[model samples]
Target: MINQNKKTYFKERISSKKYGVLMKKIIIVAIFCFFIISKFTPIHGQQEKIPVLMYHHLENNLNSNVVISPENFEDQIRTLKEEGYNSISSQQLYDFLNYNIKLPENPVLITFYDGYLSNYELAYPILKKYGMHAEIFVITSRILEKNEKNSYLNEIPKMNWNQLRAMQDFITIQSHTWDSHYKLVSNNGVKNAALYGPGYINNNFEEQLQYEERVKNDLILSRKLIKEKLGYEPIAISYPFGIKSEDTIELSKVAGFKMGYVIENKKIIKGDNLFSLSRITVNGNETGDELIKRLKS
Candidate 1:
């Protein structure tokens, strides 16, 4: 028992230490994003709870954990409609957060990360039939150019820019990162500097300059290409994998993203931290009623 207790304590100590460092690394990005947003969209002084539901794929191959069946997805949307949950955009949230604008009685924002092919084909039609719109954070590099080999592991390939354009009538397409959607792994550790988790990207992890340079390039590259291709500036960035920290949060500001979204398995609300916003990731099998129940609980 004593030995087990010691092991648990040491494990927690190491975990806490790593978490602390990660939080510290986030400080610069957090403050930077805060400064930019404060100028126009100040944080709301009042509390307003809003749920931002996240979906990845509208297909089912049972290969990835993020897949949600088209039927299930439609059911969820229907449930939201039946429940009187009005969908809102990140811009609306931002305005509400900053300007204290009046929002609908029950505002829920539906967001899809990793622009999947099914989004344009399956999800778009369903959302349209329901007269609902959503926010799609796209991966610029994955947006298939003509004749490009779709070797990415999306199961169903990502939607092309043309298809995305057609969906723009009801969908608010945004940036998920140009080339930062993938992961970087090393024997020492792994870093998702696209929107980093904790560790530095440098070999020694001491070269802060190199880290910021890579971060800047990655962030700016996505926004630049997105603006050039999509013909409109992307207002928000949904961090790839919903992974972001203070560093990435501030980088979104430098990279030209006004709002940032991260996954924290909680409902977002007005007066919520803008840069470090949380979201509830919908599982593949959980039906709409189940999601509603989870929200209530």
Candidate 2:
């Protein structure tokens, strides 16, 4: 009787220890799953806003709406520095969006569009002085044509391949599209230029297939040319005129672009679509204070 009683007690104790081990394993797995789920779960009231600022020309052409004077541009750069705004790279922004990478306490992005010579001549030095950086979106068709010694659109001068390569450290060169910088009118009466919109002097309508084909070809050619000339594939494109359609957005992704920037929406928040990002457009007219106000989080 004593032996049997001792055996029963040992069996119960061993079973209890085994049950405790199983409970511990289940608790550990539950904690790990909760941690993973928490990463994707929405926080009650917290959303991060990343501001992307847009600028066109940095030259002193008062008659031109897009041209900003060097003095004013320098002032803007100084203001950003004084305000403790950290100018981050496009890839950093992409990583932050896609990987939840942490940025500075006050993060911002400066973007220059259209591959202007003034960006190298005027803006680069100012940015350097401020210890800042910017992403320059080039109309690849213009750069390629200029390189080929062919006539450019509107006789506008753009940064050549040599200039771009020389200033690559401070400026990230991306595509603004190879040749789809024009407008195309739809089969209906609507007209827009970023992706498609502009019939003719007579406002004729464009066929759907023709518009899609144009977008695809332009994006593919742009990606190919940039890879061939720049030796690295561009990852983003600032929509021409900050205008883009659903079709154009998808085409951008298909052409290997990870992010496509639009003109409006003042601020970029945490959950904004990577394919269609928005920026704050700063014209040459706004004062440095106005630009800062526009960038408010």
Candidate 3:
């Protein structure tokens, strides 16, 4: 009777040991599958953000201080194309931020400020040649009236209504300001450069309100003009001469601008201060190699 009981106990122990080994194998396989699925799934940490480059003027006249030579502009675009860099519009960027739409690899944004006629004349062709899109920030008040060529300060004739409307099909148009005013002031004397800069200001207030009622009015007027002329309101804006204060940013937000661009010299990174977004300045002095280096850095 003792021998029989020993055999039965030994058998039961052997069966339990086999079941344990099988359970261990099953757990290992499940863990391996989980890792494989996670590896193939999309993760937010792996995404990249591209830089937005800002340009002012593109022209053949090298003597012009703010102008970039057409040849250099062409070279820059050609190099970008050769390097497989994809250029996108400001709206596309806005969409990417608002939604999780995946932009093309090596995406870039090219923007021009001041809406100089040279942009429409020279830069437009080059951008079109490369099949790339760009954004142009226009000063609504500076936009030359129909058949009116004479303007103050040799303002370099702005794009006319027809030109602006035509370009709207290819490039995104945004507001710079109604006028190139810096701050809002009441008295004309205070608005003068001797008191303040070449921008507007209100003498009623001692502290400069960068985003005063006057500034908001200008933005509203600019939006109206853009809508009437281009059939759409601008979603972005470039600070005139890259000038802004904390109040100015708030005013811009109130004016319904989704993105505000600045001319600072730095690489714009994720979680960067939105008001002071950095841009690479492209001018006649910068070579293609230098531009590439700046972008890479």
Candidate 4:
């Protein structure tokens, strides 16, 4: 009888120990899973940074140095598609900056400047073919004043209100500047500035202030016109001729633009000022391989 009792007690103790061991293993696995999930879960309110690409004319007739041929453009788009790059809108960029939107793994923002009519005729079809969207920065004054008699691309017409409205459904319409790109001369002695927009030749502090004020007024009018035409205020602006100044950034912010774009070879990343985002220029001179190399490097 004594042996039987001892055996029963030992068996119960062994069972209890085994159960405790199993429970401990289960707890460890649960804790590890929790850790992994926490690591992968999206953060609630962190801004994401990504690169924005700038492009101009898409034609073979323009200066080969500054225009991207249609075939090369198609090739570039195909490469991006094959590589799984997701092209998003400017609003998406703003959301990523303001809210913690989880952008795709390889995200890019494609933009076209000058409101070229070719953008509507040629680039639009190609973009739609690739299931991509782009942002177009229009010179509001030009759009408002463009007449039917003016020749665009020697064939296609400049985007009228109907076409512009249709584009707004797929692309985000942003402001470039009002009367800012006819002839621009920066105070830094850049020669092409005069050809891009208004020249800033004055060196006096008061004169500089006046020049800045004039620019601000023009930009303000641009914002109003964009709002009137598009029914929403634009939050982004590209400096005319990619010319930037400290005063220009401040004025842009005051004019209600949250971000600004510049033409540079660098890709945008975190810790960059929102008002001075860098862009990669796409011109006709670059082949698909060269463009890829430039972007990758």
Candidate 5:
């Protein structure tokens, strides 16, 4: 009887040990699953960083730092589509930044600095094919009144108003400025952006008030021209050469621009300065894979 009691005690002890081991394994698995859920799930209050890509021109054979070839542009656009990046409009961005509205997953903005004819002839079709949205900040003074064919293969042409209107389905037209895209040489021969300078030009010093008035006027005119032609007010301005003075934001606000963009080569996040938003300047030399890596970086 004593021997039987000993055997039964030993069996119960062994079973308890086995049960403890199973419980430990279950607890470890639960902890691992919790860690994975926390890692992959979106937090309630997390803000998203949006990448804004800036392109200047597109051409068939021309290759330059600012000019991307048509093939490369299409490749880039196609890759973006494959990567699940959704293109958002400026208004959507503004609403998201200001009103705390939720944006679509993997939101990005594709922008062009100048309204080049190639944007219409080459880039527009690819963008449309991929069902992406983009914006072009046109120098209002450079837009031709009517569409015209390019006669010279070597000529770098600007998009006309008709072309601009035609691409409105896929492209948003914004402002580069009416005529403030030029640079002024100061008395010391140091050049300054016309919109940002109150410095000496042609040996004459422009007063601060004079500089403010000049910039304000140009901004107003650019806004006016866009509204008149496009039937909507422009809410953003791309600083010429991405240069601006200390008062640039205030001046833009007074002239009715809701936001400003710069070529600072950074992604924009919520709570970023609205007036000096950042953009990634895309060059012809970057491959589609490189661009995807850049966006991830």
Candidate 6:
């Protein structure tokens, strides 16, 4: 009886040790798989974000807060390429925001406001050289039939319709506004963006109906003109001076825009407001490296 009991104890102990070893191996394998899967696969329900860059004039000698030099612009684009960023189109961005479509690795957006001729003369070529695409928002009233042949020293020239058509392959044109880029002072002499409303016009405060009428008309006209000239309606509009109100957002939808961009100085993430999306302004003074650092942040 004593011999039999000893055998039983020894067998139970060995079995316990073997089970422990198996559990440890299983746990280690699970941890390794978790690491590999997290690194290699896109996890569902994780927040995905992309940077949208807003650029203005590209000038040779004029490097202001908004006017980037051609050399620096090229550097920025080159750095973006090296960093594995792909410039997604405006429509792609919309689909990603709405449909949860998988975006390319490290997707970014390049956009220009005010539709300066330098966009065609300078930025367009650089973008084409890099095989990148961009969007330009034009003020409809400022677009002329032909280039003014003017100098950036006096007044930075606006892009002509011909120039706009020429760059259509690389540059997508959208609406800035018709004629609402200026400020409208209220009866109390407090000035604000024209889209802000309650403006002092015709020696009287603009009624709510009147303000709505003016803004809707301007946006509709902008959309209509782009469709007429470019053969397609624009789906997006960047507010003048990045100014917009709740009313403006609803008005934008009424104006037939699918998306509206604002200057919030941040990247846009999934589940954000489709209207009032954020854009990071690329500072002209910053080097390409600095710009990359900012983007990483």
Against the hidden reference, what TM-scores do the models get? 0.76, 0.79, 0.76, 0.75, 0.81, 0.83
Looking at model 6, the pairs that clash are none
For residues 1-297, write the lDDT of model 4, one tens digit per residue: 999999999999999999999999999999999898766564674434466878777776553645677787888877877777789877777666657465777788988887777788888888889888899888776673444644334533446555677776568889888777745445565555321333554543236556667778878888898788778888899988787777788888888888998877677665577888888777666666676667666
Positional deviation of residue 75's Cα in model 1 after best superposition, in angstroms? 0.7
281 Cα displacement, candidate 6 (Å): 1.2
RMSD of each: 19.8, 4.1, 5.5, 6.1, 8.2, 5.8
Whole-model lDDT values for every prediction? 0.78, 0.79, 0.73, 0.74, 0.87, 0.87
Task: Give residue 240's lDDT in candidate 1 (0 to 100).
Answer: 76
Query: Per-residue alpha-carbon lDDT of model 1 for 105-154, expressed as tens digits?
Result: 67889999888888988899999998887999888878886546587664
For candidate 2, what is the total of clashing residue pairs?
Answer: 5
TM-score quality measure for candidate 2: 0.79
Compared with the true structure, model 6 gives a TM-score of: 0.83
Question: Model 3: which residue pairs collide?
Answer: 182-199, 184-201, 184-202, 185-201, 185-202, 186-202, 186-203
Global CA lDDT computed for model 1: 0.78
Alpha-carbon deviation at 50 in model 4, angstroms: 2.8
Q: On a 0 to 100 scale, what is the lDDT of residue 250 in model 1?
A: 77
Task: Score residue 257 of candidate 2 by CA lDDT.
Answer: 92
Clashing pairs in 5: none
Cα-lDDT of candidate 4: 0.74
Runs in model 2 with CA error above 4 Å? 1-44, 61-65, 144-150, 197-207
lDDT of 6 by residue, 153-265 (tens): 47668888888898888889989988788899976788888876769887788889999999999999999999988899999989888988999898889999999998899
Per-residue lDDT of model 2, residues 1-297, tens digit only: 999999999999999999999999999999999898777654675677888888888766451346788988887889888989999988999998989887886788898888777787888888988889888888886774345543665754677778788777777888899876766555555556847442543554546675677678888888898788778888898888888778878888888899989877567877788877998766677777877887773
